[model samples]
Target: MASKYPRRQFLGQLAALGAAVTTVPQYARAMESTLFAPAGEKSFVPVMITPFTSDLKIDYKGLSALTDLYLASGAKGLFANCLSSEMYYLSDEERLELVKHVVKHVNHKVSVVATGSFGNNLTAQAEFAKKMHQTGVDGVILITSHFASREESDDVMMTNIDKFLALTEGIPLGTYECPSPYKRILTPATFKHLIDSKRFIYHKDTTLDQAKIKVKLDLCRGTGLQFYDAHAPNGVFSLQNGAKGLSCIAGNLYPEIFSWLCENVNNPARSADVSWIQEEITRLDDVIGNGYSLNARYVLNKRGLNLQVVNRASKSPLTAEQIKISDDVYKTVLQWHERLGIKV
Candidate 1:
């Protein structure tokens, strides 16, 4: 089959995603979520950041602007109240309102989902998930099961997921491998069972390892569960192996590039071209992992967007060294975008 993606027009900005695409097995080429949106919908979904005023107030104005920015730029969906939004730090009221605001503002122009389960116990998590569903989000995402010890077993998690399913009726469910308090990389067997169980329809994968990602994608191959790649370093590789979409934090910054990559993973075009483009994305991903919120604010400011007011418990201003590094990367990123003819 030939790729509908025009070779020269798209993926012209980034450095080199070519080598990375070659890592994709010739056999592992899937781009659609079997049970979700039809072909040509947005696949690069960004876990949105909560914009705040300098005084630490929820910046509704900023949120509105950011929301508009994402929609105008061709985002197929919006995910809110996730770790990228700093879910652990937000109060119940804030989380609910923010998800509501994003869903309502997006106005069904795109799919919407949010992480409603905070540090609350499983029962409370379920209740809150239902409330979030009432806010009109397409799905309510749950935090990864936390264990005081990382030695917890799949059997134990299976029992817990059952309880979550019992509580969250009527509303759809998703899971995130959020690493804040603790992170659980669901075992391949457990993930296959989760997909077979018919309760979970979404997964935010953080394994960050291509080998493991391949196993998970294999599990959900014929199911409706859409696996989103959370880790950025191997993002393009995962896409080739049939990750339904990308839930990368970088999407908020450069959605056009993300969308272009997502649009062409299964392209019948030159594999070298695809691999080089993926390498460039991984390069940007390297720059992003340095710092999450602060780095984003710095770039957003450079792009004439808003600054963040909320701070992590140990948050401090980005050091001069950090600022210079981010600015240099930012400059290169902007140049790349210009070369691709993407409107900022």
Candidate 2:
């Protein structure tokens, strides 16, 4: 069945096939510029920020110090104004200020990913995304519209995403899939379509469903989009499944611990070490994470991080009983921290 063609021409055809195999979409090329280092280059472990102060103002000094601490602790990057960062309670100006400060503090030690989600307003969120890119940040994390059951909400989210991509030019983008706070879920098909659009280069999977996580991982394969587990309590298993990295609020308090767990998770010889850390972290989560309440913050403060225990002034303060319970939990975590050789 071999046809008589010149050997040189046949070789050229094979080369062309190789090039075609490697080619990526133009938009994806642009997105990849800021996405995690080209796939297989290096995996990144990012810490989500939790900015708070007693006066309800953005803690500029504390934020700067924390940013420095995380980078020094071997974190690969920072995600500002995310769920852990309490983005909902912040004003537009305060959000921008936090992004700017984190950018300045990080000073290129690691990439900065800023959250651009706001209440169902695509235009405004796009504007913020554009500004974030202009400030030299690497990426924006967009949350789908909250609590909207309408088909129109999906349309709005898609349109807004398109607008944001167009406006940011070459900035990378990430999507945060947090089902608890947002009533609507982005189905597997819809998620694949978005990734196919080449606008987003990452997905922060906060949904704890193993089945859904597998779907996202399958759909994102070969697209060069990175997936991270925001559900830290389940992160070890998530990484084993397919997550490229970990991004969690727990990283705010135990940056080095999370960083070590991530590095060890990838090395077969270190599985035992990672298992020990994961077990301790899971125990802490059992006591503090159930309510998503004050216990986590109090534990952070007790360890000398000075994070405000209150969620947000705009939201109701933690009840007295909740505060007392949180304090008890904080003491217990501190004891464990010392036992584990984690610095307070």
Candidate 3:
């Protein structure tokens, strides 16, 4: 028999995983009063969707148009060529061109980063990262080392990271626990090594386990490494627990909601307000996504940007079932947005 709590996993209630309580951190409140407060707004960096023409080539103009929409819609940061962008299907040249284009188009309007590393060849990967850094992005993030076997020793993973880091020269680095080919949730020891490097500056923790997330957030504090929990359900709870910001796929559709959470994380008075917003976010995700990329395209279409959801690596154009969900969820989110008085 299936579990009754369909939404529990999505909402971060995975108590079986030994997750601890996620609460507001006093350190975050105190940081605001200090001079060395982390620069940049606590913002959501949407893993942006890639637009495709009828023939599947990059829609350069369409991409620029999307940038305008994101900037206007309250996105303070943009993540490019991530799994959300179908990085697996894109060629190296295409990824570089896409990043360069986004950097120029965004033009310092917000922080920009991309998943620059792809395969196991650390030399080429580092070269690509170096090039991406020159494109004016704030950082280059490596997808977690999924190439290694599950039985692969921690030392091998650490050595791979060290090799990759040595080659990335002047680029600021971050890691995304992207469960793509597979997910390798970083051990606390690996996270500590990153903090000690003084070079790895951001982490998109994907474990979604509240206890471990708290541990990661605590480790990141004052070390200048920003920990952004990638799982949406934990977003609000994690924010209150000293997470520096949020980076999630859901931001592609609902940046305004995430941006609001980041800004108001410290206000205990908004507890009721934030809880409702977060619930809406997760509930909408439950209905609107099998994976966010295609769903995002449909919503963008519903919002009036037309593009084919033509993806070679996965489902494209969405299923009939998904489109039905899209219609219902779209209407619901609009109503919720109005009720919440949200602008985007």
Winning model by TM-score: 3
Tell me how candidate 1 scores on lDDT.
Answer: 0.69
lDDT of 3 by residue, 1-344 (tens): 11111100001111343257664322232223221123645767778778888788888888998888877767677888787777777777788888889988876666687887765467767777777776766667877754255689778878877888776654567788887766889888988987887767668888978998888888888775777777889988788888777878777666667777887767687778788888888776666557457777777777777767665456446778877877777787687678667876
TM-score of every candidate? 0.84, 0.76, 0.85
Give the CA lDDT, 0 to 100, for residue 8 in model 3.
5
Clashes of 3: 0
- As for candidate 3, its clashing pairs are none
TM-score result, candidate 3: 0.85
- Model 1 agreement with the true structure over 68-147: per-residue lDDT tens digits: 87777666777898877767666778888988888777776777878866534667667777788788776678766542
Instruction: Give Cα distance to truth, residue 308, candidate 3, Å.
Output: 2.4
Candidate with the greatest lDDT versus the true structure: 3
lDDT scores of the candidates, listed in order: 0.69, 0.63, 0.71
Each candidate's root-mean-square deviation in Å? 12.3, 12.2, 11.4
Report the C-alpha lDDT of model 2 over 7-120, residue by residue, as the tens digit. Answer: 100001112346448644434554435344334432445545555677666777777766766776677767776766666656767777778887777677666777665533
- Report the CA-based lDDT of candidate 2 relative to the real structure: 0.63
RMSD of candidate 1 to true structure, Å: 12.3
